[model samples]
Target: MRILAITDLHGNYSKIIPLLQKSGEIDLVLIAGDLTNFGPDEKAEKLIDMFESPVLAIPGNCDPKSLLDVLERRDINLHNSSRTIGDVTFIGLGGSNPTPFNTPFELEEDEIESNLETLINEAEKTDNVSVLLTHAPPHCTLDEVPAGNVGCRSIAKFMDRMDLIVCGHIHEARGVMEFGKSIVVNPGMGSDGYGALIDINVDETPKIDVQLIKA
Candidate 1:
C-alpha cells in the first residue's frame, strides 16, 4: 500500500492542494495532527474535502478538540481509534502530552496511556500489520527538544509491537528512526511543505519503504 503522511499543517489550506498535487497517486493519506491553529471546525472540514483519497486524521496540540466533530462529520477522524485498510491496521492517538504553552488539545500521560492501551488491544486482534499514527513521537526518538525529550514514554515502551509509527510534534526533530521492530517517522510540519511517503509491500515477506518529501 502506498501512503502519504503529513502533519502540523496549522491551517495553511493553500499548501494542501499543492502538497497533494506533488504526492502523485497514493492509496491513502495519514494526517498526524495540527490541521488548524486554534481555528474553527470549518477549517478542518475544508481541508478534508480537498483530499481525493481516503484520509485518516487526528487533531493536534494547536487544534481544538472540537475539530474531531468536523473530522467525524467527514468520516476521517482517527483519534484514539483503529481502522483496517487492506493488510494494514492503523491506530491513532492525537494531541500532545502537556506542553508549556498549554495547547488546546494537550492530554496527560495517563490519559495517553489508557487510550493507547485500548487501541493496542484492538490492533492485536487484527491479522493485518499494525501501524501507529500519533501526534507525539515516542520519547527520545523523534520528539527531542533542545530542553529535553518531551515525548510519550508509554509510546516508546509499546513500540516493539508495531510495524510502523507516523508521528510529528517537534518540528526540528523530523526524521526517521528504527526502534526494535518498528520504524518511526516524523513528517515535520505540512504548512512548511514537508511530508513523508510510505510504501508497504505485503507480497511474500512484508517490506516497508519510506522517503521524506518537500514541496
Candidate 2:
C-alpha cells in the first residue's frame, strides 16, 4: 500500500499543503509527532481536514494533553492505539524519552520500553506485517543527533525485525536506513516542510520504497 509518513511538523502548514496535494492514491497518512507547535487543537484539526485518507497521529514532546483531549473530541485516533489497513498493522507510540528541555510530551526510558514491549506483542498477534510509528528514533539507528550522542538504547533493544520503523525527533538524520531486515525512515522536519512517501508490499520480502518530499 502507499503511505505518506511524516513527523515533527511543529505547525508548518505550507509544507503540509503540498504534501496533501501530491499524495495521490495513498491509503494512509502516518504522522509520527510534533503536529503542532505545542498542543493546539485548531492546528491538528486543520491538518485532519486536509487529508482524504485515514490519518494516524501520535503526540510529540511538544504536544499538549489538551491537544490530545481535543483530538478525542474530533474523533481522531491518537497513539497508544493500534489500527490496521490493508495488509499492514500500524502501531503508534507518542512522545519521547525525557530531555533536557523538560518537554511536555516526555516519556521516561523505562516507560517507552515497557510500552513498546506491549506494542510488539500486540502486533505479533495480528496477521499483517508490522509497522512501528514513533516520535523518537530507536537508539544508534536513525536516531542520531548533530551532537553525536545517539538517543534511546532501550528503544533499539525492543525493536525487533519489522517491515518498517518510521520515526522522527532527530531532524538531522532525516533519511532512510536498512537495518536488521527492517526499513527505518525519519522524514526530517515537519517544521521545515519536508517529509517522505513510502510504498510498501506486506507480503514475502516486504519491499519498501521511500521518496523524500521537500518544499
User: Best candidate per lDDT, number?
Assistant: 1
Tens-digit lDDT track of model 2 for 1-215: 88888888888766777776766678888888888888565788887787878788888888885677755675555577777777788877788877888888888888887887887788888777788888888888876666775567667875665778898988788888877767788988976777788888855354678898876
TM-score for each predicted model, relative to the true structure:
0.96, 0.92
Q: Name model 2 segments beyond 4 Å from true.
A: 203-206
With a 3 Å backbone cut-off (N, CA, C), the pairs that clash in candidate 1 are none
Name the weakest run of 10 consecutive residues (lDDT summed) in model 2. 70-79
Worst 10 residues of 1 by lDDT: 201-210
Local error of candidate 1 at 173, Å? 1.1
178-203, model 1: which lDDT tens digit per residue?
98889999988899989999999877
